[model samples]
Target: MNYFIFGGSGFIGTHLINYLKENKAGSKIYNLDIIENTHNGKSIFINCDVKSEINLNIPVSENDIIFNFAAIHVTPGHPDYDYFETNIKGAENITAFAEKFNVKKILFTSSIAPYGASEEMKMETTTPMPNTPYGISKLVAEKTHMIWQAKKNQQRQLTILRPGVVFGKGENGNFTRLYWSIKRHRFFYPGRKDTIKASIYVKELVRFMVFRIENKNIDIEIFNCTYEPAFTIEEISNSMMEITGMQRKIYKIPAGILKIAAGIIGAFGGKSIGIHPDRVKKLMISTNVSGKKMKTSGYNFHYTFDQALDDWFKDNNKEYLS
Candidate 1:
């Protein structure tokens, strides 16, 4: 099958490319993104910006898959307007491009942000109350894809995956920062250790996406994509220590002190320290998202959180220590 990926240079996209090559999943893969080439010469790269109007230049055919992973998703990184401009506009253009070629399937990697910051377990059917510009933009992007699918009627298939925090090799996100802190013996919990962090391994996430693609059914479908048994920060830290063989004194600082520190650091523009007040606040909240749809679909997960971390450490521990 011919595959086209938008934002194919980003973390998850890079992993997907590697997965396809390792599994020999596609005959021809076209990677579309604004970033310069990051793939291993396995994909044909087209330096196209999804926010801009341009031809994707991909030879379209029936049963072709268009995977949209493009978005300005880093919280507190870009301005609010940029999120809507890139995410919403990117979805708009991708759907239009798919329509132009009559692409058979379009798989979208959305986020759990649409449900907003939650302390309770969130389901796929939860009423989205997006509280941030990023969340609002992602929710709108999902709607845009649905609109395109509606136009296709029974002729096209769509899979919208709202994934939780995706982490693995080469992923520089919250989870990675945690690893760094543990490695340096500076790991600490601001208050409690039971804050649920919903997450999925990048490889496992791509595998699930590919599974859905190969078993495509003609319908507009959506699924919450994350590993089962939502893990707490304590659980993750314990796993990290076990895998990396690193022991650090886990400090339990008062939440109030950390909150004040976060505010002062954020006011001074200290995101470099990974201590924005907003982010610190979010860390206290549990994003216990449920992926029951994926589980009930009869597809067993390849890696639990522990297994995923083991694979990541096996591949990256040498570089991680340096």
Candidate 2:
């Protein structure tokens, strides 16, 4: 079977492609993305933007699957309209392409951001109350894919995965920044240590996605992709310290003060200092999400939080020491 992956050059996409190459040896994988495929050269790379017409001459079969990982996902990074333009339009175009090719299955990577910041543990059945542009766009995108599935209810399969702060090798986002901060001895708890941050390793995420697709008995499945009983700030920091042997006396800084400092720095081009008002505000919020649906589905996780960190350290050539 062929695999058409949108945004396959990204961190998650690169890992997914590698996994498919290793597991599904004979399958032809086509990566369609605006960015160049710098990680996997063996996969067929086609320069295409999801927001525009996805015109490809490659052969596709009814059994082939489409994976949509394309989106402008970084928070506090892009204009509000950029999120809707890429995420919403990208979903429309991808489903259109799937319909055109008579593809039976599609796996879309949505975000837990659609659930918004809340101390309450968000479940798949919970009503989404997205506040940010990125969150709103992701929620809308989910509906767009659902609309496609509803049209061909019996014949088509759609799996929408709403993952939390995914981290692993090639993830230079939240976890990486935290690693660097702790390594440099500049890290400090912002106000409280109990702020919950729902996270999943990228490898585990792709593994679960594949598992759901291969073992699926239903036409549509929407699962929240996150580790159960999510980690708190203190627990995460302690784990990093133990795994890397980078023990340092953790400190607490007032969230109010940090917010003020971040605001001043942002106003005076302080992004180089690695603190922004939005980022500071994020520290105070909890993304408490529940992964009960995935767990109850009987898919055992391949890695625990600590194990994932160890593997990531190995993949990065043990850069945790540097």
Candidate 3:
């Protein structure tokens, strides 16, 4: 019942650590990451980089579960090589640790980017058509873990969750940025408002992971983890506006104009204006990945777009918004 979470300092990992501790799960939880996760005081912390050549120093048992959430995930943030180096190597090292330490299961939180930017509904069975370096690296990382699982005759369970834009209290990504924009009455619907942006609440994602782990089967299971019906940009913006009681004017900026603006701003290389060409391009595409597997597994998502926003606003106030 023990848990070892790699990349525990990041948003999703931080939430998972707190969830495990709050539930009073009667087992020690070890965190391995490049930086110390100070959010949870009870969990044991081990400063270890997954990309480093050195193996992790934490003790592991056959009953222990290793969750690999470590990766260079920010699409516009890292160089192409950095993505491959960190994600692929991180996977290799983590799986190697599992093999060496005889850990019973490895749960990896991969991104929906592996399926590439698609307007169509992408299921777990869909062939991965990764276009970006980050996408390709994640796909390779999945393969690397699968190879390790095969070494154990597929007896050691592997659960890979491909989550999309997971958001909650500490999130600083798209959701957080959008939240502030709406709060300030400055948010706009870029390009088409109908484009679906798949996402999950961080708490729900963590809960689903725990549910899967507790009822784990020996065979490998890959689930596309997000809310049942992915929210469109309009839906998200409307929810934000309604929840915050701010009826901000929704500007309809053209996609090409946004791209050019992002390009010009990104070229300067000064302090980030929070808009990059990659991020702009991402906004135009539909990340409508399907969560059929998780839904079919009989797990009910507790939050919709509006409910999640309400919970976030209630639980986290000025700090997260500002």
Candidate 4:
């Protein structure tokens, strides 16, 4: 029942680690993060980079379950190459280690970004066309899993999970940004209120992982880690507004005008204005994910976006908003 988690202190991993601790599943838990995640000290912590050619620090046992959750998680500010090294090479290192160490199962957390499907409801059979470096790295890592897992020297079952935006207590990205924007009464609803933004609450992801560990009857395969019915962007936004008691002037800000503004700001180096052009690119598109396979794989849905926000969004808005 041993478990090893990479990037255990991050937004997604933090919640998962906490879930493991609360369960106290009678197994040793280990986390390998470069910065040393002592924020919560339940697990054995080792500060080491997954990109290192050799991971000689931690010991892996035959019954150990490894969850590869480490990654750069790209944003507008990152150098493109950094994403490949951190995401792809990192996964390779873990997969290689699992292969050599005779680990039983390796569950890798990839991103739905690799598929990069538009408004269409993407399925497991969708042809992935990754547009960004982060997306490419994840897809490349996923494409190579079958080879490593099938090696004659290994007894590992590789389970790859591609999840959408995961938010909960340590989230400092898009969710927080949007929450604060709405909290400040600066919320905007582009007239197209129907555009859904696919996402999963953090605890839902943890529940999925733990369930997989407990049920080893199924064959190892990739599953999309997300809620069954995706939440619309406006639905989520309105929830935030209602909970925070804030109201802002809502404007449609014409899509074409916003695109032009984004282009101008990007062309002139939006970094000075604290906006990375790539981040701007992220806002203009919609990413809706499907969890049919994951659902069929035995994970039941847990948190709706609003219900999830209510649990995590307490007074922390002060620190993040300021």
Best by TM-score: 2
What is the per-residue lDDT of model 1 for residues 10-101, given as tens digits with 9 covering 90 to 100?
88888888888888654788889988666768788999999877585546797788899999999977899999999999999999988888
Per-model TM-score versus the true fold: 0.95, 0.97, 0.94, 0.89
lDDT of the candidates, in the order given:
0.86, 0.88, 0.83, 0.73
What residue runs in model 1 are displaced by over 4 Å at the alpha carbon?
Answer: 267-269, 317-322
Candidate 4 TM-score versus the reference: 0.89
Q: What's the number of clashes in each of the models?
A: 0, 0, 0, 0
Model 3, global lDDT: 0.83
Tens-digit lDDT track of model 3 for 68-103: 999998867788999999999999999888888788
3 or 4, which is superior by lDDT? 3
Clashing pairs in 2: none
Model 3 residue 75 CA deviation (Å) reads: 1.2
**lDDT of the structure predicted as candidate 4:** 0.73
In model 1, the number of clashes is 0
Q: Residue by residue across 79-189, what tens digits does model 2's lDDT show?
A: 999999999999999999999988889999999988988789899999999999999999999999999998989888999999988998777788888888888887778
User: Candidate 2: lDDT over CA atoms?
Assistant: 0.88
Task: Give candidate 3's total backbone clashes.
Answer: 0
